[model samples]
Target chain A: MEFLSYTFMRRALLAGNMVGVIAPLVGVFLNLRRLSLIGHTLSHVALAGVALGLFLGFFPVYTAIIVSILAALAIEKLRRDYRDYAELSLAIILAAGLGLATILISASRQSAGIHSYLFGSISLVGTRDIYMILPLALVIIAVILKYYYGFFYLAFNENEAWLAGVPVRTLNVVFMVIVSVTVALAIRVVGTLLIASLITIPVAAGMQVAWSFKSTIWLSLFFSLTAVNLGLILSFYYNLAPGGTIILAGVVILLLVLLVKKIWLLLRRDL
Target chain B: MSFLKVEGVSFAYRKERVVDDVNLELKQGDFAAFIGPNGSGKSTLLKLILGYLTPTRGEITLKGQPVAEIMDWTRVGYISQQVKDFNQSFPATVREIVGSNLYSKMGLVKFLNQELEKKIYRALELVEMEDLINRKIGNLSGGQQQRVFIARLMVNDPELILLDEPLAGVDIRAQDDFYRIIGNINQEMNKTVIMVSHDIQVISKHANKIVCFEDGRAYPHCSQEFSYDDYIHDLRRTNLRIIPRHDH
Candidate 1:
């Protein structure tokens, strides 16, 4: 309780909780649309951006933002042009970004940049970083809530939505942009390596028991907050990496849900 | 003028012509079925009508205006054969699925308030699915899914409804219910319906008109003299080898 009185600890807690909330909220749609892999791919692209920023003498966050948006555009264009081979296109972009990062890192004079981005140092997060991430997360969440129906329609059945005048192409671009923004904002807390888990695990856990779309979203948000808060507390106590621990906690919870669901089914049959 | 006029329309995939030199017209409030064996371009023609595919030659006009110039899409509703293509485990409620039709009408920035909620309830009620509004789409049976899709279509208040194989994979009781529901939509609402069906016997019994497809062309059969027995005999005899195997 004494530790919670510190401003730094409070700031870290707030930031971690915000990220945990936003990631899974967006993730419910991402998982449904089968775009979970995009999270991983964009995080790797951010890694390249961070490495490039170190070499070019710019703010890594700004570089990460630019690189992530570019990756999103490339993904959207690739999917449109090669709709039949979209998966291959995603793989190619992911590989290219990672390869660029590897080359940049090998030629760099300093190694601190790679280490910081790989394993996020949440304790080192500044007030400036919090200010940047908070509004971005808020705006993205607000936009998503406003256009929930359009996104749901487009994700479920694109052709039917198109015929009903849903501006399918524009919505697709907007959705990709949202994903890019979330990945960019999450980099400080979750890092590039395990950010996708923050997006995927909560939704996976919620799906085991959710019978409705609205309930599923709420459940995902609950699981995500629990994992992040718990993981942060454990990390602070044990002096471990917050992002990795949070992701592991989420996975464990998801497995437990699956186990419980299976047991319930078995018990019902026996009766 | 016809409610829908498709003139000299020809469509091809890559280099293979699927609908060749075809012409069709449907009057307002007509309930018509397009029937044929596999790959006979029944679905292709419907796609052309819905503006999903471009014709290599000629144009499609809706109510005297060219379909390309028509910006109002709320006037049309469509249901595809691939509703089951969605992930069975996707997290969406039956109400959400039905309510999705309102997106285009409400635009992106609008919120779904109490009035809209009432409309969603009404739409679900029409399909007799009001009680299952909170149920996940994945949990519903095939017929139920089709009904939910119908409820989605109804919210749009379309002048024309295009359905692709709505009866496929639905059980007999569900099919009867579907037919009755469609009958009510046509008779009560006076909405034009164009459907693609393989059940020639059922189509003969229920559909007001039939459009037969063979060798990449569509021919309309007048309901007054159309015989179910003769039509079945001709269909079975003409395409014996290509007939798909039936499980039941």
Candidate 2:
């Protein structure tokens, strides 16, 4: 009870819960649209932005958010310009961001902040960080829930959606923006290296059990909440890296779901 | 005024003109079919009318208004070939797939609610897929998937429906059923339909008008008495019958 009373613990829980909710919500569509790799790419772009901010003596969060949005726009434009080879463009951007991040980190004399950003330390989460993450998470959730059908339609069949007047292109841009914001906000908790797993694995696990699209989204949210909360608690207890632990928790849950699905199928066949 | 007018339209892919010097017109509540051999510009012409591709030189008008200017796409519905361009593992139910058509009508600001749910089921019922609302789209048979796609087109309640080879790969029984459904949509709903198909026999029975494409020009055929001999000759010369089968 005393441990729960600590302000830092309360802040960490709130921040972790915020990211836990937003990542998987976006992840459901992300996984469906085969844009799961965008999360990883944007995270690395955010890291490069953070490194740049560190080099320039400014707050890394603002720089990270701006850089992520730019990266998102660049990716969207590249996809449009090179529709035939969009994946190749994504790979190029990802490589550029990662390569630049490595160079910036190596060139810097100040290594402490870079290490902190590499593997997130949730103990460093302050009130301001909570304030920044909470509203963004809320906004992302609200927007996605409000336009669930649009995203679903766009993901399921883009050409059909266009014919039916779904504003497929504009909705695509909006979706990418939401993904950029989610990745930017999630950096504090999940870090850049493993954030895609945090977004993807929970949905992968949820898909195994969910019968309908709506159920899959809800179950993904549930899995995310469980993994993030448990991962946060375990990291607190064992003095481990929070991002690494959360991702590991997600992977473990995915494995369990796959095993359960396999067993259920075998048992049904036997019966 | 014609319900739809396509004038002087020419479409090309990288300097290779696929649809050249084409003109077409459809009256209100007409059932029309576009037929051609392989690469005869049937699908390309449909794409131009649907605004998926820009005509290198021409205009398409719907209800006497330029299609590009009128952004109200609720009046236009489309079903493409059964190509399965989507991943087979995609997670969408039959109801969700059909309900997606409502998005354009309902707009982006609205959420899918009970009213939308009812409409989706009603659309499914129209195509006899009310029983399979919960089935995953990928799990259905090819015929069943075509029915679902038809249901998807139905949800919008469009005045004009364009279909690209709805019977491309289905069994004969399914094809007959599909043609019956199209007849009902045209005869009962009075919706204008323009389908691109190669089946002359089925089109002769179902469609009120037919347009055959050969050598980049469209030849309109309105009567059932038009010789299948001409079509077969065009098909042999242009080799339109050799459709590249898409791997599902």
Highest DockQ model number: 1
Residue-level lDDT for A173 in candidate 1? 88
User: What lDDT score goes with residue B244 in model 1?
Assistant: 47
Where model 2 places Cα greater than 4 Å from the true spot, the runs are A1-3, B12-16, B54-58, B222-233, B239-248
Q: Which regions of candidate 1 are displaced past 4 Å? A: A266-271, B107-110, B222-248
Candidate 2: C-alpha lDDT: 0.83
Model 2 fnat? 0.66
Error of 1 at B106 (Å): 2.1
Q: Score the docking of each candidate (DockQ).
A: 0.64, 0.60
lDDT of 1 by residue, B1-53 (tens): 79998899888898888888878888888889988766778899888887777
CAPRI-style grade of the A/B interface in model 2: medium
Interface RMSD of structure candidate 1 (Å): 1.9
